[model samples]
Target: MLRVLAVDDEKPLLEELLYLLRSDPRVRSAEGASDATGALRRITRALEAGPDGDDGIDVVFLDIHMAGLTGLDIARLLAGFARPPLIVFVTAHEGFAVQAFDLKAVDYVLKPVRPERLAEAVRRACAQLGRATEAPAAAAEGPPGGPPGAVPAVPGPPGVPAAHRPAAEVTAADRTPEQIAVELGGVTRFVAIADIAYVEAQGDYARLHTDGGSHLVRIPLSTLEERWAARGFVRIHRRHLVALARIDELRLDAGTTSVRVGSAELQVSRRHARGLRDVLMRQATG
Candidate 1:
């Protein structure tokens, strides 16, 4: 059972989330907060109590806009913590999705939340938590009665024409064949190995931020990392993988470190902090 903490300024929305979360059997316990400050206090108290106390919160559903401190502000504070709960932003606005994804949120659900959508969000949260907590063997097993790597059949004729093939049948090629082509100024530009600075995951697209400028490339961050990890690009965050040479400065704030690359300030998670520091130190001395 996953423990959830949901925060929203609206009283009615908070009540609805509380009720829906409690109704789900998978949710062991749930809590609600009307503002960011209260939510932070609750989270801090919960964390101090450790994982076994008061049904620890595995995920947080945050609203971007609030009266005092915004959800993004709260998220930044939480990111500085030693162990922060997985965040899922729930807001009426779609504009925050890119920034939310950049912050490595589990999911972004729109406002006027439907029961099905909420349930789906919870399901995804559970899956993400399971991936983080469960053993390797348990995670490898397919869903009940399904074989490993098996694809479900679509309701269509067996001998369908190639042109009339199901949309799902078209295989999306991996971006790491040789070199990826990025479009800038309506022209296709091929980014070489040494010139790329970082690759950031923006929902379905990956933004390639290099020395020249940023370009949107249609590729998954995981794919880019797997292909370029040998070429000096390091995965500093779930959303960001940066080139070691592109790092301009590192700032430390209250034991939390932020790396400066161009105009962007990327956060280094506590779990990855030591490794990043070691890498940067080596770069400095060598």
Candidate 2:
């Protein structure tokens, strides 16, 4: 179980956060402060009380834009502590994601919080705190049998037949891929990597396709290929990195080779075709 401190300037939002945190089975206690100063004071008292005491907070769900000593400021101050509580930023702004990650935040969640998404954040905090917990179905389920409902097909790259484009990739092994942060209309949201069907390279950016929708992230395709290789993403084309489990069919048409993923069928480059086939066969047999 985890002890949580939820900090927000707004009373209603703070109360809501405390309520949600208290509702989770993983949380032992939930407390709230309406401003960063009060939050810091409470945290200091808890720290002085020591980890063996009931007052020691394990996590702090902080709001970034408070009036006095902003949440970011508090985080920076706490950084000097020998054992600072885990931080999870809860805010309406998306621009501070890079900074929050730099502070080693457990998660960055947007405001008007969803119960399911907050649960995912809690799970991450637990993992960081070396506590064990089960992930909620909405955030944990993998494909072939994702939460039921027809997924809207992601539109493929331009000039390619939309139905024949590659789907996204996810970790097939025991390790769960870290949630990818996506910025949409100034609001940041996290997309679980397990939900992705395929990846399409777009210059320095890679678009992640999933059942919910596609998200364009600022990362290189080569970078993802290397990072996710152990997780089952393979480079079948210079522009595509696809999940082995999501590949529905392999096709050969008059010496040309292609693979189908979800509703998209992507042409496999000659250089990678043999390797792709070998790996697919290995996966099929195993």
| Predicted structure with the largest lDDT when compared to the true one | 2
CA lDDT of each prediction against the hidden true structure:
0.70, 0.75
Tens-place lDDT per residue, model 2, 1-286, is 8999999987645755776677676778989999877898899998898866768989999999999798999999989998889999999899999999999999999865766678889999888878887744532322122223323322333322221123242222112356655432212345667787799986556788887667665567897889788878899999999988889999999998999998898999999999999998898899
lDDT of 2 at 17: 72
lDDT of 1 by residue, 90-134 (tens): 998999998898888889998655445666677788887673333
Candidate that would win on TM-score = 2
In candidate 1, stretches whose alpha carbon ends up further than 4 angstroms from where it belongs are 131-286
Colliding pairs, model 1: none
Residue runs of model 2 more than 4 Å from their true location after superposition: 135-286
